[model samples]
Target chain A: MAASATRADALVHARGLTKRFDKLVAVDAIDFDVQRGEAFGFLGPNGAGKTSTMRMIGCVSSPSGGELRVLGLDPVIDGPRIRARLGVVPQADTLDMELRVDENLLTYARYFDIPRDVARARTQELLEFVQLKDRAKDEVEPLSGGMKRRLTIARALVNEPGLLLLDEPTTGLDPQARHLVWDRLYRLKQQGVTIVLTTHYMDEAEQLCDRLVVMDKAKIVASGSPRSLIDQYSTREVLELRFPIDAAPALDGKLDGIAERVEVLPDRVLLYAHDGEAAASAVHQRGLRPESTLVRRSTLEDVFLRLTGRSLIE
Target chain B: MTGALRVVEHHLMVYRRTWKGGMFVSFASPILFLAAIGIGLGSLIARGPVHTVGGVSYLTFLAPGLLAATAMQTAFVETTYPVMAKIQWLRTYDGMLATPLTVRDVLGGEIGWLVIRLATTAFAFFLVMVLFGTVHSLVALLMIPVVVLNGLAFGAPIFAFTATQRKDKGFPTIGRFIITPLFLLGGVFFPIAQLPPIAQGIAWATPLAHSVVLSRSLAIGGMNPSALIDVAVLAAYATLGIIAASITLPRRLVR
Candidate 1:
């Protein structure tokens, strides 16, 4: 009966999900669905309600209003049941400082009622999977930031959860560390684990999320695959021209016929057009002298800027 | 209740890593204090101001009092800093909740571990009492669980109070204002009856004073059925502390 009611394949289904804290509406009437075995994402700026929505889906925070079902179970009624099948990696590293790396995973497995021997076996396997086997005996306090994040990821996988929720998985790491985590997540995706992550990095969203929702100010402003969102909201390419303060004119009026849209910034002018090369030549033909010029294909950053008119990172 | 034992198991694993470091401090400090106060002062206390307290040597009278005090200090130490650490610093409880465990299980397990630690510390202190010839009868062996209850009388409420705090600055305040005063005035060093009549009323009201009365009664083979009231007081504290923790821990952790 439960499977016959909602979408049989939808692991997480939310309709008009609202989360308010006192007078502040952190997540206001947002709606989305997460399908099984897909790498889904929630993309938004800071304070844009990304973490609030993830907490709701994680079954730790009950919604203020509206409907939310995770894995065909009511979040408020069967929170523990829903949580048993879901793995969560919070935004911050919550690893035990006193316990060793392997002890962290082993202690967590006991909460799920796993057998002691089975939990130990899984701990060993997960430590190897996250490439932390060498540091299994080391305390969590001494490991580097990236190593701690990997250990946290390993700890989340101790139960072999079907749906994994990652909230800002790599927010404070360098480029090398971020890629290492991305590589591990991509492998998990290939193995058919449903992944829902929240990130502000366009490249991270583009590289990992098969589909995503862009939220701004507690509402879903746009939702689609990264490629389709870029195509729907922006032109094919963007021609950037940085000119001296005095040389640049009323660029919107001056470059009217060259591109579909023109946005002027203090340091540069963006000419949105289907043919960036053509737009650049048109600017040269008009005898407009600029300091520098570059043409590139439209990216998720462009789509985000067009939708919210603010950068993803503050 | 379902997964409370698992929570205890988790704490046991963490304790395994650091137990050896605290071995000397857990047993040796209490032994030294018993020696200095029980023997050093027992000599002076033997001849001075009304010798033969409760018709026994001064060391024997103060031995049971030290047992109760040891239980109180052990409970406070085990519950306060560790509870605050798991709530704010280590974040281990948050990790547990992400699994199948609920807030109730976590709290139950933590208090359970505190009780076990109190028992072990009391056992070590009991050995020291024996070396000094303070154990007078077979009834003294029953005070192990009694000491655990006495510790919980303080440990449970302190754990509940520490769970609600945002910072650890209040911990030292509790030590200075609440714990220290209880140690000084709660009939640990001398009989509460020796104090002014008004001070005697206040001492009898403290949880430590109740435990001291019960332990000393049992140790010297002088217990009567009326001693059940002392057990009732400690049990009430443990129950109330558990209830308060169940209510307040989820508010701070789940949201």
Candidate 2:
């Protein structure tokens, strides 16, 4: 991409961007830079400032303290100018349910000052682009959840935005719906649109992100690619053992030397190891084979668990 | 404020699909009301000792007042729920803000659309008044602008108030307590002189009273120098409404 030659190859640059609402500090001082044509993900649990950061990047909210620059323009000074070239998918579906599917697209284009004919043509192309062409004449209220999401994505693409900021693009979607949304987003990334997304789903970050920053308690805890984060923070494999609750706590001592680290929970125990089969065999060698066991490769979820000391989903 | 007109343009597009729902209030309600009030109620008034009011038929005297009042009604209706829906329910304003539009542009588009709605419905009411032979002079054509002003006078403040609402329980009170009294007692059915002096003083402070006086004089043949006072009063209210909306809407939306 020609963006590599630009003066500021970073399309988004932030340093200590902070947002506070009264007594609560929603976003603590956090800094990150997103390069052009890169698909960056903010992976975090709720209340970790993912959505707040997205809003700041979208130019819809002002920073209470610190600096934020989108496309090299200060959001406070050039909000509208910067927003004209961006697309945002909010966490909730805010589609105009009263209008037909196509009207929502056309209305959005008008906000960018696109002429009527040009808007109509673009609306047509976008409806087809999101695979909602057949439902263009339908009311927005009745479309399925996934279809509504696709239509929103299409509406965002209507302006041909250089940067697309999606806040949990697949939060409420089913697995099938989530995959399709991810597919369309991947296609946009392949088309060279700079994309920044926020998600709590570690697999989503691993599946789609070229680079990711794990955020927690309003601060970034870890930042790197999925493999690098795992390699940096977690063992290559994890062994899971589920004993009856009465027997689970006592087995921790038996499996002490089997793996590098052990995580004890009420229902199961996680054994972090470089080789899962050898670790499970080590458990048997200690005469502690009273439960079921399984081995799996470490993922971003493990990396998150290692960093935050809490499960990603729970 | 660049691309502010697109906000109104966005509304116009939505109105194309949704205006039918509002037709009862905008077009049909006025015709039904004029027929019921001017023709039906005026017949009873004509039988009384004072058959003529202000040297004209009772129905003719009442037509301009109702037209101006209807303008206020339509403006209130257009500005209140639509603004509330955009801000709270439908979040259309949020949708616009996510684009290049700002909160001020959204407010401008909203108030601008309310003005057009007031004009269209007022024009429809004028035709209904003509059908009942309530229009007495050709200058009645100017009632459109006066009606638009009256609607804006009410719409602007309502927009300001509605933007600050988190729930809709207060909306019904506005219709019942504020708009209803203005419709009934703000000189819509009779001259404020018929009331006692204190009541008359209170009526003079209202936008509907000033709007009614301006509209009635414009519809009839005699609009004297005092009509300027009515214009100034109504214009002041409209300006206040705009100022208040600009302040409150951004405070509500930007947060």
Candidate 3:
């Protein structure tokens, strides 16, 4: 294929990729590139087509239209070849609950046609890498949610894939568990694994992603480094104001020009500005005192809300 | 070659770890059927003219038929629920597909495992039949491969069904609508000729009927040209079922 020349640097490349489910277009026409050994992310809310796009990249789902390549191979014709070089941690843990933790890793390694001795060695190494060496023999059904998630991550790493796909790696994890997973992922990144991940957590996006695309409703709204995205789409600081439901309108027209942008949410109003404390003081100077006020750095969450209106979509 | 061996190793691992419960059920059911039907129902038919191809007793005549039926039953049970679990509940196929193995390799591995399971169960049943003096001649040895073929006939179709099923609601329907009827009408308990002409014709169409006739004929040293026809029918069923399974498996899994 023509992709071989570019394969040296680009781990994943797509041109006008799109996926449609009958009448519903889950992933609209979009393009992106991921260089080797880079940590990339897809950040969006629920139903933002992140998982669908990941599935396409993982070679599990066929793209409806446009050009897509992974590891310099077409997914439709070379699925197994591409998939062999890819590791996937799906959004929902699809671990084999019937098997022991070690067995799960062993069985997964067998799929790669890895020799028994090699699979055994890799399973042991991965179990240690994910900190599940002690629970290796335990049945997966009895493992805690965090343990299972850790085991799933470990299983994905069994092949030592060149391109690792993690869809919401920290979702549903406790704070301690999330941090533990983050540490492992960071180590993998340092080891020169090219990671493509998707998460709704802004903190997770900021913590792991070297570059990201913010998706909303099946389309890319923006794409850049997290810092660059925040700088390009939003200001450096944010001032949060909380008002009584009845008194919110009294200050609405009074607080204009104090910040670069104002977003009114159900619980609070966010003011985007270069200086959060200055924006907060300006709000008070206009003879309007919110019930509570706090100033912090603007985040991807604010960027998402600014792009996609605040409506709870199913 | 390594791919096929990996599947075999996987099956062997699972069998060694889980077969205690399976062995208990496998031995118990056929023995209970032997006691209840062969002893309880055989007594009523023993007094009547014994339907012998070459001077075998009524219970002896019934034993080979039951063995083939049991092999098919075990194959169906193993291939259906476990196959469905691997596909849906367990997501084993998804995991396997992500590897270097193609969907055809998975199907080959599963069919290979079913053959081994059928052989093991048939061996155990053969021993039980021997203890009961069901062997009329050394010809009963040929019944082993016949029983394996019987398993493939049922296992292939069930495996194909399982590849398409998204839930377990249809499993009982397959048992009730297809398996149970075939068990009763397929001449497991009696000769097909005893049925009315139309029912006999319908019974002959089922793979179980062919299995019973072939196994019983061989058990009493009564092989004939029609045995070739029975073997051909079984081979046809197995080939078609396997091809259909291979074609359907990728469609289901790749989606």
Listed in order, each prediction's TM-score against the native is: 0.95, 0.96, 0.94
Candidate 1 segments whose C-alpha is farther than 4 A from its true place: A1-6, A243-255, A265-267, A284-291
Candidate 1 whole-model C-alpha lDDT, 0 to 1: 0.87
User: In candidate 1 chain A, where is summed lDDT lowest over 10 consecutive residues?
Assistant: A1-10
Query: What's the i-RMS of each model?
Result: 1.1, 0.9, 1.9
Q: Pairs clashing in candidate 1?
A: none
lDDT of 2 at B164: 86
Indicate the residue-level lDDT of A119 in model 1. 92
DockQ, every prediction: 0.75, 0.79, 0.57
| Chain B TM-score, all predictions listed | 0.95, 0.95, 0.93
User: What docking tier does model 1 reach?
Assistant: medium
Better of 1 and 3 by TM-score: 1
Worst 10 residues of 2 chain A by lDDT: A1-10
lDDT of 1 by residue, B3-99 (tens): 7898999878878887886666767876888788888888887888777777787788888888898899888888778888888887878778878
lDDT of each: 0.87, 0.86, 0.84
Q: Write candidate 1's Cα lDDT for A97-172 as tens digits.
A: 8788988898889888889899999999999999999999988888989999999999889889999999999999
User: Mind giving the per-residue lDDT tens digits that candidate 3 earns over A112-190?
Assistant: 7787799899999999999999999998998878888889889888888988999999888899999999999999999
Interface RMSD, candidate 3? 1.9
Query: How well is each residue in B1-255 modelled by candidate 3, as lDDT tens digits?
Result: 566666766777667678898877667777787878887777877677754433656677678888888887887798888888888887777776666677777888899998999998888887777777777788888999998998998899888878888888888898898788878778887778889999888888878899898998887766856998899888888888898898878889875
Superior by DockQ: candidate 1 or candidate 3: 1
In TM-score terms, which candidate is top? Answer: 2
